[model samples]
Target: SGSRAVTIDTTPPGAPVITSVMDNMGTVTGDIANGGRTDDTTPTLNGTAEANSIVRVYNGTTLLGSVQASGTGAWSYTPTA
Candidate 1:
């Protein structure tokens, strides 16, 4: 055996993109540039993320919902009013 040094690098997950947000009317909206807002209290949110990563949806400090990205890095979540 010989003396050796090993270094471990740690990196956090990347931020998930809220690419699409659905309104209560079931209409689909575009990306965050769309502001992720709607008149309806309950709406579905869809986005892309690192595969298998957790995507947490929030409004200010309150958490709306959470979802896991699929192998293809696609995810969707809907919150209750």
Candidate 2:
């Protein structure tokens, strides 16, 4: 009862991938890349179909974050990575 053991994995995960938005029309004001989070800034949605809709951020089809346009017209996210 004087010995202990533990195991850990130290392999770094792959980076997230940024893909084209579905039906993306207007130029995104903030960073549109994967893991990109915007706050207090509205993306220029001149021709965007759904301006105030829940957009899903992903990495090679892996769901990352769901950004929603707030009352202040901004998107916020706290990435775990």
TM-scores of all candidate predictions against the true structure: 0.69, 0.31
Per residue, candidate 2 scores C-alpha lDDT tens digits across 56-81 of 55559898667664543344443334
Model 1 CA lDDT for position 30: 38
Name the runs in model 2 displaced over 4 angstroms.
1-51, 71-73
Q: Against the hidden true structure, what lDDT does model 2 obtain?
A: 0.43
Instruction: List candidate 1 segments past 4 Å from native.
Output: 1-9, 24-33
Reference-based lDDT, each prediction: 0.77, 0.43
lDDT of 1 at 24: 53
Best by lDDT: 1
